[model samples]
Target chain A: MSLELIRDILVATVPLLLIFPTLFAFTTWLERKALARIQNRIGPNKVGVPLTRYGGRFSLFGLGQPMADGIKMLFKENIVPRDADRLFHLLAPILALIPAMLVLCFLPIDFPWINNIQDSVKAFMLDGAVIFFFAITGLNTLAVFMAGWASRNKYSLLGGMRAIAQMVSYEIPLVLSAVIVVMMVGSLNAAEIANAQAGWNWFIFTPWGLAAFIIFFIAALAETNRSPFDLPEAESEIIAGYFTEYSGFKFALFFLGEYIAMFAISGLAVTLFLGGGAGPGVAALPWLSVIWFLVKIFALIAVMIWLRGTLPRLRVDQLMGFAWKFLLPLSILNIFIAGSALHLLAGGRLAGLDEKQPILRQLMEGANPLVVAGLWIGALLILYVAANGLNQLSRAKVRPREYKYAE
Target chain B: MSEQIAFWILSAIAVLGALVAVRKRNLIHGVFALMIFFAALSGLFLLLLAEFIAAVQILVYIGAVGILLLFAIMLTERVAGDDGRRMTSRGWFWGLVVAAAVFVVLLLPAIQQWPTPEVTQAPDPSVEELGHKLMNPYVMTLEVLALLLTAALIGAVTAAQGMRKPKEEGSPE
Candidate 1:
């Protein structure tokens, strides 16, 4: 290949390879610190930065913790079960880490506000990026299964089974919710989806979009196997689930994969629901868009950590039922609602909206407040009724029995 | 030149994967081989510059269908050591005969006379253009396909529920 071509390839890939792992490392520290604060304790306060004046005093509030964790993981002994499938055991972590990192390459870090500037921040751009993202992320389940089954342990097998079931169940809603945004935006390109929400036209501001976002966020939580939906790796129940047999760097790889996947899905949520990289003054200063993007991602990550600190892990049956019986139907209905609303209000178009025009513009344009509000209210009403109806259906079939506690 | 080489490589992978998928003893291995086959076909689609179809090929086939295949294989009791369950060597012979007849009648001619328009390069349709074609001209076909899939799903669910009822009735109370 030519030198210029090689340079271009590096320019695209190098940042992705570097940034995601670094982000994962820092996110671990952030999660620990946040969880600690939530639980009323100081976390990771003993590791200090080298050569700093207050290095020993405050320990830089444990800024060096992730580095310390990395070193410890590297030096830890690699253990393999005697009866384990050694080849698959070796392959699983690599399988897990690679796809999570690949998802990061599609997410645009910032849209260029300045004219005539090279907008090469995103590593790869595909016409069907949304599909690409889900397709790549779906590979994570294979890794989980490999790790679980290869271990040859019952707990690991159960964990892997739960992981597969959870992933398959949640993926439907996750894709459906994303499909709603795709329907509204009329494009599967991630950048175009983000740009459609320019100047505070974020999907989260709309009622139907808000419902889709909530569904997407919930599914994303299960997708990453976070708390409440973390039945796969529930420590108390399944002995750390699929990664039970892993140790040393392999164990660290699972954590790295998990955190990076968390960030990727959150980045997707930002791109789909929130106006990705679109903030006040982002137009005047293009670099600030990057900051806005990071802020949104970190904020979402913080909520995840908060959830980890707050909620109890859900039962496997409950988790699967919630995904299949609730989230999936809700999301499907959401797609129908969003599609009809878009066709009605904007004449099946998200773009071409005159920002200056009032919500109820000219009748001929079909972009009016009455149509928009009616659609939103109609969607919300349908959602409420559907949820209530489903709740009654389940409740009617299986009534909750009162438990008698030992006195 | 590079695209041709890539196409050849992908075709090799797809063919080899299909071979392994058919020949593998272990059901899980066979399922994974099938996944590789589907994935390679997706790569071939990408090579042909059908990005939408390529992504959908991966998304639907590898992501959903492959996982379902894996789930079925994993959940079933017939993972290994089920040689006697087969219908016998005569069945394989008949299957080969049917497959050969189909290949001769349908596949061989399609491969030999595959059409390409008189153009240097094929037009690369954007996602918008692809959507327009599907929604406008091919709407009936698309709806029919969708309805067929939905009916198949319902049939599967009904069959599963039917099997459960007989088992429940046959069990001692």
Candidate 2:
């Protein structure tokens, strides 16, 4: 490749490589502090610079903890069992790290922050970026299995198996929800998807979009092995699961990979439904777009942290059932609802609002809110009926418990 | 020149990876090799400017299919070790002969000294056009495929569940 092309690639990639890891470290600290506060304790208070000079006794709130942890982890002993498969044991973490980094390559961070630059400030613009993101991110399951198998430990194997099952199950709903957005926007390009929701026209305001977003977020939680669905590495059950035999830097690699993947997917969710980088003053000052993107991502991450603090871990069977019986069917039906809604609102000849406005703008403006509301209500009715029917079906299969008084 | 070089390298990798995937004795190693094959194939698709197909190729085949293969391998047999038993029966020679025949048939077009067609640059179809095509003329085919997949899923679930004896009768005891 030419030097110019190489430079362009570097300019695009360097920020992502640096920023995401830093964001991840910051998130780790944030989650600890937030979760700690929720549980009525001071978290990570002594790790950073003390703010004794500011009259109060506020420290940096353990902001430096991730950095310290990183250094300590690097120095810690790297351990591998004698009977473990040496090559795959080493290869697994590297494999896990690959897809995590790759998914970030397709995400559009801002809407042209640089002067004399193009419309969008994406790292790379691939027409099929959405699918590409999903494809690469899904490869983590293979890495998990590899790590589990290579460890030659039963806990690791169990962890790996659980990871594969959970990831594969959740991926269907994740993709299905994304497909709904694709249906609405009628493009797979991340930039195009983001741009479609420019201004205050974010998808989350609508009913189907809201449902799809909820499904997407829940599926993302499971896919990333976050709390409530983190059965793969559940501490109490399988003793750290797939990475049970990993130590020091290798374990850190897995941790880094998971957090990065979390950020990357949440970034995608923002781009799709949250009007990525679409905020006040962004239209006039485009550089503010990056800040908007960061704000959205961190907000999503904080919610995930909040979820981690609030919810108990789900049972394994319940987790799988939730993905298949609930999410899969809900997501599939949601695609139809989204399609019908789009057709009525945007595709019809009568949908145009004004003669001068663009078709999309016309559709957004001219579409009857009352009719749209009715469509969503009908969708909600169908969903409620479906859920109720499924619940009754499940209930019929169960025998009621009979209680006897002590004799 | 660079594009040609990339195409050649990717095709070579694809072929070699395919060979290794089939020839490997250990199932997990074979699966990993298959992943390489798929990756190379996707790279080839990307080279052809069929980026959507390339993404789908990687997503479905390498991601989903690889996991499915692993699950099947673990479910049916041990994760490590091989008995070195041939997967096929005594008809291996015929299978090879059939494969060679098929390969020859497939290679016949490439083997001929065909005239180079006048190169015409066509703007690559956007994903919108592709989606329109799928939902329009190909909608029937898409519906059929969906039905086929649903049927397959149901069949697999039933097979996994197996033919259990009536629980009602057993519960009476």
Candidate 3:
């Protein structure tokens, strides 16, 4: 309602709106270049060639490829499959784009651009950002399923099913890893988490932090349906997968949504793990921290591209197995470890750790060490046994005779 | 005023979508409508100062649930049956009466006794505070949720395995 509060909301949201589209564009370019390099072929090298005395040069192997792709997609004919429910087919892409775009609202690119200027403005500001992030990110799965179903193709249907299964499976680990970070920092606001890691002792230094980082990275990969986990769009198996029937701008929306989602995930990971926008001893130049955050995000994105180039697509069963059998248990353990360590450190019971005045910390520390150790060991044993049991169960269920081809 | 206008438009779209979801014979339309409903709900959540919940609502319901429903519908049936007729039988009068009764029941309290706003508290329920609460006093709840999720995973895998096709005894004729 107040001018100052309105200014802050505008400032926070404006940059996000501008930055996300630009980032999405950059990701598309990066993916193409990376994929091309991996395939041992020249890619998109003919665009944006300036006519110089040197007879023009292909710039960055056509870094403007995304622009070209975008233009081409826009002009292409929008085809609705004859058998498709036309109304839903038309709606699905828009539905997908909206949720993907909404995620940016919760992301804290920098400190709240506006302090407490007006009470009304404060209401709009996202304080519990991590929860918002997870909630928004979870919506992408629904968008994907909608696309597949709207296509009315068997391949699309299968792709949708695979995507839903994979996403739901990985979401557990994704959330759990986030919980670990929350456990360590005691806050879910992305900006606050970054602030907490202001100094050298970023959460990444802790044992649980490392585990969380790995879990989050893997889950992000799976969540985005990038290669090694891209069964949803496995070209060889399911053709174009969910978006098989889409063409033109509708198809482009899906494509843009994917890149944007990837960027968002990378931003989230950087925020939670790599001290988002927080630089080393550069607190004076707060803007440089933003650069640091972007650099970290870029590095993460490059790693994802590398993953796409290197790893083969996972079989659906294997993907599910990895999520349920490995990542879930690991995430749970990581949370426990993080919680206990924080408790110990706060109480000063652990040597070289601080003794906090908090009674909760004291209680946790005062508890029997042997009991804690036993519980930890017991958890590990149970996980191991459960994993083995699951493997056995899956093997028994497969029953080799069932898969035999009946000619 | 503009924000309110946007909210009304989005809310209307969402309601329309939900209606279409239930009324349309085409399963795919229903899924799309559900997505619209989610998007609209998310918009509503945003209006309510529950941005986190809004985002999650869209992400999970629109992105995941809508997509899953779409897939299920597509896989189970062909598109030829996608008439604009109702998929389920309509009990219009009874349905309206029931819906109206529920709405009144929910709204009557607010209408009769307007609630007083509480004093603004310090250290507002920010994301950080939520995290601290979750890890500290509510640590046991977090642990329990984790356990519940693990059990669910085990159960899902077991059920999937159980539904696997029976082994073929010999080659088909």
Candidate that beats the other on lDDT, 1 or 2, i.e. the better one:
2
Writing each residue's lDDT as its tens digit, candidate 3 over B1-173 gives 55678788988998898888777665655666676688788888776656556766866676556655665565567644545555545788798899899999999887775777644453343444455577789999999999998998799779756776777889584
Q: Tell me the tens digit of each residue's lDDT in model 3 across A102-218.
A: 776655555444343443433223566787777777777776776787687999978978988998889889989988776555555666666667555465655566668888999
Residue runs of model 1 more than 4 Å from their true location after superposition: A50-58, A111-124, A343-378, A395-407, B78-119, B161-173
Q: Could you say which candidate leads in DockQ? A: 2
The order of the candidates by lDDT, greatest first, is 2, 1, 3
On DockQ, the stronger of 1 and 2 is 2
* CA-lDDT, candidates in order: 0.82, 0.84, 0.72
What residue runs in model 3 are displaced by over 4 Å at the alpha carbon? Answer: A1-10, A50-60, A111-125, A347-407, B1-18, B31-35, B38-173
Model 3: how far is A76 from its true place, Å? 2.0
Candidate 2 on A1-407: residue-level lDDT in tens? Answer: 56655555666677778989998888889888999999999988766643345522444666768887899899999999999989899999999998999898777885342223432234346777898899999899999999998999999999999999999999999999998777666678887888888878888877778888999999999999999899999999999999999999999999999999999999999998898888999878888998999899999999999999999998888888888888888888888877776667765574444422323444667678788778768877887787677666544355677677743
Alpha-carbon TM-score of each model against the true structure: 0.87, 0.89, 0.76
User: What is candidate 1's TM-score for chain A?
Assistant: 0.90
Q: Going through the candidates in order, state the TM-score of chain A alone for each one.
A: 0.90, 0.91, 0.82
